[model samples]
Target: MYWTNYHGHSNYCDGTHLLEEYIKCAISQNVKAYGFSSHAPLPFLTNWAMPYEHLVLYFKEISELKQKYAGKIQIYTGLEQDYVADFNLIHKEWIDLPQLDYIVGSVHFVDRFEDGRYWEIDNTTEVFKEGLQGIFNGDVSQAIQRYYALTREMVQEQKPPIVGHLDKIKIHNRHEHFFDESASWYQEAIEQTLQTIAQSNAIVEINTRGVYKKKSKETYPSHWIIKRMYELDIPVTINSDAHHPEEVTREFITTAQVLKDIGYKTLRVLWNDQWQDFSFDEKGMDLK
Candidate 1:
């Protein structure tokens, strides 16, 4: 049994270690396929994203690593691109570069700040509160709604192969401090977003970043949400969202079991140069 993870990071962005370190760790963990998904380069002020100047170097190094590790593991290139639609910030077209194997479209920046910086919902809880008070005037419902709205908009516009970390805005709602996840409005927002995803060819990734990082007790979409996705017949892929070598498959053991319990018999995986559904167990996917 071997793991298949595509959403990961490296020193090019916010992640630790060089690109090759992650590959070595993946091999040690019995991983058969992996992808380098550094945070896509941004046009505006942000410290975490890869610099626009680094794109060529990132691609070149990955190309070299792909050839070096060809027979040992399946390596692919992808980026976690954020969908920004703030007119307040000057718009710049995304730079064209060598083709990527896939893209994990995500909504990290909900909206821009008054000074023109973007509000990252995935950042420190302090930043979230600041944005909530300053932007939404403390209206959690409105804030959550806007997040989902942007998510749906990104899906419609980009139609990326993978929709990353659905419902990640809930990361700050721990202990129900802000609002109830079971609230009618919250579920409605999720339902509406799922409807949009259902119509598209995009696959929803069951992200384990929140779980292993201790940010949440459940995966990005949570268990009930994955069940909802199953009802809609939305395909899913399990991703570690690894930022470190040791975290490559951090919570996959339990996540896979939870998925199976939720009636997911197969997972979407990129294998043999194609994304296909394959049978899997808690240990790992059956690539045989």
Candidate 2:
């Protein structure tokens, strides 16, 4: 069995280490394939995303690492591109870069705040509350609906290879403070989004960041969502969304067990320059 993680961050963005450091860590951890998916450059200023000017160097560095580590472990270059309504990877000037192997389309911003700043959903509890109050007038349902709406729109327009953290809006819903996941509206939103993904060729990632980060009790998209995905025949992949070297395979074993219990037999992986499905267990992928 082997492991792969296509969603990761490095110093080029807000991650803690250089790309080389993560490469070395992946090699040590027996990760068969590793991809760097730092936050793509945003049109406006932000702390976590890669600067517009730094994208050139980011592409260059990942390209070099791909060659330098070839034959050891597969290296892929990607970006965690955000879907901000009309502004998305499809509209980015650097979307056509040849070095990019794949993209993980995510929605970190839902709508704008009163000050015209894009509301960030996962940054902090205070910020989330601010957005919830200011944007939706404390209506959690409307805010959650908007988040899923943006995700659906992104899937329709951008059609990225992977969808990052499908139900990440639940990150701040600890103890069901805002609303219950078992609610009818939430389930409907998720089911609708799953229907869209079922129609497209996009793969949903079983992100372990929330679980390992202690932000949530389950993986993004959650167990119920995964079951629905299986029913829809939507492809799925496992990604740690690691920001540090030590986090490369965090909670992967448990997440795999969760998938297995939920009746997932194979996971889509980028292998030999193609995305293919391979059987996996709690340990890792059975490459053979």
Name the candidate that leads on TM-score: 2
TM-score of each: 0.95, 0.97
Regions of model 1 farther than 4 Å from truth: 87-96
lDDT top scorer: 2
User: Candidate 1 residues 190-285, lDDT tens each?
Assistant: 999999999998899999999988888899998989999999999999999999999999999999999999999999988987989998999997
Q: Which stretches of candidate 2 lie over 4 Å from their true place?
A: 88-92
* Clash statistics: count for each candidate: 0, 0
Looking at model 1, which ten-residue stretch has the lowest summed lDDT? 87-96
lDDT of 2 by residue, 1-288 (tens): 789999999999999999999999998987999989999988898999998889889989988988999889999999998989767544465546687889999999999987889999998899999999999999999999999999999898888899999999999887448889999999999999999999999999999999998999999989989999998999999999999999999998999999999999999999887999999998898764
What pairs collide in candidate 2?
none
